[model samples]
Target: MYMNKSHSRIISMVALVATIFVMLFSVAYSSGHVNHHCNDSADCPICSMLAQCESSLKSLGTGLIAAVFYAVVLSQIFTVSLDYKYQSVQTTLVSQKVRLDS
Candidate 1:
């Protein structure tokens, strides 16, 4: 689907902000130290697995957020450039028409 210049800019800004907020929250949540008390051998694997899972999830979340942020910014840039190009062409066309009508 295609969106107009203003609409696309707003959407991109909102997405970028949302992604940054999520990234910050995830980083903070993952940085906090968790103390796990394991009494038996069987419990040790569970605790280790849980930690590993959390770490993996944090890494994945960070990567995904970064990707989204970059994508949004790039798209915004592309849209703005397109709009500028379009306006320039329109102005040139109008000037040529005025000259011909004179």
Candidate 2:
């Protein structure tokens, strides 16, 4: 579990890069428009319903993407913190062992 300071730094940098990539991707995808075609018939209940449904789905999709992006970022952070803590504990244990042996 113990990782050198350099290794930890590398892992952090990678995580940062991944976070940025995901954010950019999500933004690009969300900003793209969705094309829906409906007839121009007066009193067409189907067209009205379809438009409402399309709007609702688009909103839902955006919300889902945002949620997923946040989740990925948070999980990466949590993993890095856990790894750092584990490394610290291992280093402490090794130092203690060395002193005891001496």
Show where candidate 1 strays beyond 4 Å. Answer: 1-37, 40-43, 86-102
lDDT of each: 0.71, 0.67
Pairs that collide in candidate 1 are: none
Model 2 misplaced regions, further than 4 Å: 1-39, 86-102
- Residue-level lDDT of model 1, residues 29-93, one tens digit each, is 44553555568846576566556657756776788899999999999999898887434545566
| TM agreement with the true structure for every prediction | 0.45, 0.45
Candidate 2 lDDT over 1-102, as tens digits, reads 899999999999998797566655544444442343457735665555555555655666797799999999999999898887434445566676655655
Estimate the TM-score for candidate 1: 0.45
